[model samples]
Every structure is written in structure tokens, then in C-alpha cells.
Target: MQDEEQDRPLLGRTVGITAERKAAEIGAALPRRGAEVRDGAAMHTVPVPQDGELRTATESVLAAPVDRVVVVTGAGFRGWLEAAEHHGLADRLVEQLTGAELLARGAKARGAIRGAGLVESWTSPAEESAEVLERLLAEDLRGQRIAVQLHGEPMRAFRDALAEAGAEVLPVRVYRWTDPEDLSALDALIDEIIAGRIDALPLTSAPAAANLLGRAERTGRGEQLRGALREGVFLACVGPVTAAPIAAAELPYAMPDRARTGALVRLVADRFARD
Candidate 1:
């Protein structure tokens, strides 16, 4: 504790993490290195219902005329299929997935689609909604209907972009994150961000950024959070792919050359001196 305090006087800089897992691996990386991490990781382990609305949704999509399907979240695809399996819909679901042209938002989404014995026709260059829209615009889907699997929060812009390009876009909202039933940790993190008591954030996912912003709004710190991002907090996303959310914040951000955690840490150390 003493070493951390001495090493990171910028302990004043408190950054928060809202990751899928406990962020045990990445949480330890931020301390005393000039960044104080707010271990507000809400593990994205919401049980994929063995059978429920999710299964019904999956069955609905499977039964629909899916000419092309876009897999945005790898975990979402797995959860969706898992839910369907409990209802004895895996074989048919697999069959439904067979003929559609698969579009992957990035490596993670691609992994999920391939795991289902499928593959992507094109993977988003930047693993973001904007990039995905650009890819679709270039594909000439004048009248074809495309299925976009919703990842976390709904991206209205993504669907709108596809529709503008003359493609009938059908979105599948498979899974979404809810704040940890206990909101104290999340609350404190938002407070720190609003106060600009943070130098950098180790952003893990787009939803993390969205969720933080949402929380700030609920607590009446929306402007405060945005200001912190612009004037104080230096966001360091895991990869260029992961930079989308920060960029969407319209806040200045720094990202690593590659989509790797080690690279992100190194990039931070290289650019910012130990304060």
C-alpha cells in the first residue's frame, strides 16, 4: 500500500472499470502506475436463460427469412444459441445460420459465428458501428434484408445507417448489461469521473463507456463525466477496435497500435510520465 501511494501520487486520478469479468487481470495493472482503477467491474455473467424470452427471440430470428446475418457480439451469439438449445432449437438454429451471409463486427464476433459452425463474409475494420455501416454501404445490399445482432445497449445509429443504405436491417437484441445490483461502487466511480480526479481510464469495451455515461446521467453528472473525458481523464482503450466508444464520447482518447492489453499499458507508460 505504501509503495503504491509513493509510486502513484496521481492516486488522485481515479479511473473506473466496468468490465465483463471482475477485471482481476486488468484491475491490478492500473494501480500506482499513475492511475487508480475503480474496480467497478460488473461481470457480464447474466445467466443466459435456459429457456425464456431469449429463446423465443432466437427462434423468431431462426424462423425468419435471414438472407444475411450480422454477428456483433461473440458472447451474445453463444448465449443466444445456448438459450435456443434448451428449447430444442439448436439443430434448426444451426440450419438457419447455414445459408446466411455472416458479417462480423470484429474478431470477437467472428469467433462466435465460427463457433456456431459459421463464418463471416466481412469483418469490421475497426470493430465499431460506424465501420460496420461503412462496410455494408460498400456491399451493394440494395434490397436484401440484413440481420444485425444487438450486442449490449441498442445502437440506433447502426440500424439507421443500414436502412439509409437501402437494406432492410433487422436487429436482434440478445443480451444487455445491467448495473450490479449494488450500485454503490458504480456510483462512487461516476462521482470520481465527474470530479476529474482521474488521469486515465482503461476502457475494456464500448458498453463500459456507454454504461458509465448512462450512470452519470442518472446521477445528474452527465456533463461532468463528459467534461472529465475532455479536460482531464485520458482514456486508454484496449485496442483501436475498442476505441470506438471513447471516440463516440467525442472525448479525446489514446489507443494502442494493436488490439491487446499489454500494448495499451505500454502505450500509456510511453506517453505519460510517472507522476
Candidate 2:
């Protein structure tokens, strides 16, 4: 089977990748399947400096042990830890958090917490902030102090829910999302999709999907581009979070059973086979 599969099923097919951190790996996955890959890194992650919002949140958490702590993303947690380490407070921060009732949003967060030599009291099965809030609300959190490490964008709804339940929430944004320095490449990709020069586009995050559509709208090609995607261009997302904006736009898309990059590639390959 390995010998037969070497034929590169993606040959003559074109797919787009919108991830920055894992662009090389994801880009490589497509060509192996015989598909032409387009790099569509929509945004980059920028860590907040030591004297930024994260530092303030760190000071507050270290001042006193929080009643409950929520970790939203593994990468964000690692970034926070690195920042704390730089300030020579990594050990203290870890010690303080270990005393709190640690909660994780998903497997990734749980892994990060465990990697830091701490244990989580529980983790949200849904792997999202809304679900995390749900699990936390199930407890008697009135007047409890909760510290949240936001991955990138602020999860305002999750924070608001905690406040409504009378929990003192310290929401810390450890990083920010900035648009790609050059979107000319993205614009060119858009032109290819609209012109039927491309076959599929896989989006790993919601922001990239939203920004792609936003760009099309700004260039007055929204309808034309949307039409192409809905009709022929295969729009594949890693999972629901990435698919949410695409769904909201009423565009048709495909997602694998698991939200992994390998699964996404297999999904596209299988999709082409079925058609």
C-alpha cells in the first residue's frame, strides 16, 4: 500500500494552509498527497512584554493564591511561564498556582499544566472556554477569585459569565494576534480561488478564516469569492472553532472527525476520492 500511495494523490490539486507556527509542517503534508499547497499565514502571535498586562496579572496572582485558576491554551500557558521565568518569579508562580484549584480548558491546557509540574482538578471535555465556564459554574464560585490565562484574543463572554456568577475574575492576555505584515500573498490566493486556479483551502483558526473573508469584502470581491468557494473550492477547517466563522458566512466546508492536521489532510484526500 505504501508503494501505491507514493503516487501523490494530490498531484494537480491545490490546497491552502493558513497557519503560521506550523506552516512548514502543514505545507509539507499537502504535497505528499499530491496537492499544490499555498501558504496563507493570516496572522502572527506576539507575546506581551514583561511590563505588560501579563506582568500585572502575574503580580496579582502571586500576591495571594487564587481560589481557582483556568488555563485556556497550552502555548499561552508556556508563554506566561517563560515571561514569569524571565522576571525570576517562575518558581513562585508555579508554587502559588499549585495551591489553587487548577482547571484546564482541554487536553492541551491539561498537558501544559502537567508539564509545569502541577495537576488540574478537572478539564473541560468540550475543549472550549464556554464549556470551561459551564464546568466552573457547576461549583459554588460565589466570591471566589479566578485567574484565567487567555491564549490570544480575549474571551469576553467567558469572563462575563464568571462575573455574573459573582466570581472575581483576573483575565490575563498573554499574547496578541497581529495581521500578517503582507496580505498581498493572501490577496493573490483569493484571486486564484476566484479564478478557479485553486482547489481547496484549509483553515486551522477562526481568525484566519474571518480575515480572509474580510479581505474579500474590502476588495469588493466577497460575493464572487464566496460563490467560488461554495460551488467548487473545497473549504476545509480543522474543527468547529475554525469552522464557526465559515459557517456564519453560510459557506459550505468540510471538517474531519478529529481536529488534527493529519486528519484534515486525510479528509481532503478522501473527499476527492468520493467525488
Candidate 3:
């Protein structure tokens, strides 16, 4: 599986991934490694957002004069606005979004928010929720009202920290990462793994890994197959949340000092070359 062509170069190499649009950046990076890209939407095609909660949360934000609004994910950015648009609240959402202190958790998220004509007051240190919250805590949130947008799950610590700092925190759950409704995509992901077609894997989230593993299990070759795939393949994770599922599965994996995609790709490129 060592294609020295892609050893340090990473070209002529293919990493089976399911990240939707983010995959473009990931794919573009591989060419620097001399890698050609292969698509596997089952791997992690980004989830389409369902914004029932976002509507309620945005209304809450408009209701109160909030001090800051933290948006967590790029998907949330598009989804929130789309949700607002659907309900004839696009203009209102934009106005409200701009009114408060706007914080973004990742580069893509920040980019999306800024593209919408709102500047981020605070951009998180890294993609991790805790890191975003840590940066927020450094600010004087005391006696201030803040609204946080949740991607999938509640960030207990982030919310608790705001409360501890004497600030009122409102949670807006904009979207959810759902279990794959279409098993065909799941099946193909398993096939790629079993075939050892994935040279290197970059995991952005635990759910993506779990989804692949689940697909493997359904095919009745989960253990026997993943063992072989794990051999020739390098598994890289962006951060703790992304790495946890691999550790839980007791699989060998690597995580970078920083969770950004740049860091993740660099770690993958450098380590594979070194090994």
C-alpha cells in the first residue's frame, strides 16, 4: 500500500471519504501528495439540516437583546439561513444575526457567516466545541446574554461555562447528524473498506466512523474485513471527538495537535511518509 509516489507526495493515492463539500478541500490536498481522489458519499456526505429547533432559537434571539451569537458549523450556517428563508424570516434572521456578537467555531463556519455579511466577533481556536467555549469564556460574558447554535448535540460544558460566568446562554439546535436512511450508500462504504481501496482515512467526526463500522457489521464481515483494511490504511482524526470512535473500536489511529483540516492533512501526509 506504500505508493512512494504518494509517500510524501500523496498523489496517485486515494482516500475513501464521505465528507460532502468539505471533501473538495480534502481532495485538492491529496493532489499535492500525488493522489487521485475517489468519492464515497456513504463515508460522510454532510447531513442535510432540519431546523425546527433553529426557528425557535432564532425567534428567541430576536426576542431578547443578546450580547453574542455563536454559530458552530458551516452546515448550520446554510441551514439556518435556509430555514429562515423558508419561513419568510431570511431578512429578519440576517438582521438578528448581525445584531448580536457573532462567534464562529471553524474556518469554514466563519467563512460562511462572513459571506452572509456578518463578521465574527470571536473565531474559535479550533473546531472543538470546548475550544470555542474556552475562547468565549476569555471574554467578559458576565451579565450578558448569549445565544449558541448547536450542530447536533448539546454542548454541556459550553453552556455551563456561560452560566457560571453570570451570562444567560440560549441554545439553538440548528441541525442534526442523522443515521443513514439510505443503506445503499452505507453498503458501498463497507465494500470500499473491505476491498482495502481506502489508502488513508480522515475522520472529521465520530459519527462518520460509526456509520462505516455499522455498514460493515450489517454485511457480516465487520471484524474480518476491517482488520485487513486497517493494515494497509492510515486512519487520521481531526480531534478528540473524531478520534474517540476509533479508540472505542480499539483501532489504531492518529490525531494532530490541532484539529483543523490543514493540520489533519499535514499529519496524514507527514506521518505516512515517515512511517
Which predicted model would earn the best lDDT?
A: 2
Ranking by TM-score: 2, 1, 3
Roughly what TM-score does model 1 have, to 2 decimal places?
A: 0.77
The TM-score between candidate 2 and the true structure equals 0.85
Better of 1 and 2 by lDDT: 2
User: 218-242, model 1: which lDDT tens digit per residue?
Assistant: 7788888788778876778775445
Clashes of each: 0, 4, 13
- lDDT for each residue of candidate 2 in 95-151, tens digit (9 for 90 to 100): 989889988978989999999999999987756666677788888889888998986
What residue runs in model 3 are displaced by over 4 Å at the alpha carbon?
1-8, 11-14, 36-38, 43-51, 90-99, 115-117, 125-128, 138-145, 152-169, 179-182, 195-197, 225-232
Q: Cα deviation of 37 in candidate 1 (Å)?
A: 2.5
Better of 2 and 3 by lDDT: 2
How high is the lDDT of residue 136 in model 1? Answer: 71
Report each candidate's C-alpha RMSD, comma-separated, in the order given: 4.4, 2.9, 4.2
**Winner on lDDT (1 vs 3):** 3
The order by descending lDDT is 2, 3, 1
The TM-scores of all predictions, comma-separated, are 0.77, 0.85, 0.73
Candidate 3, which ten residues in sequence have the lowest lDDT sum? 41-50
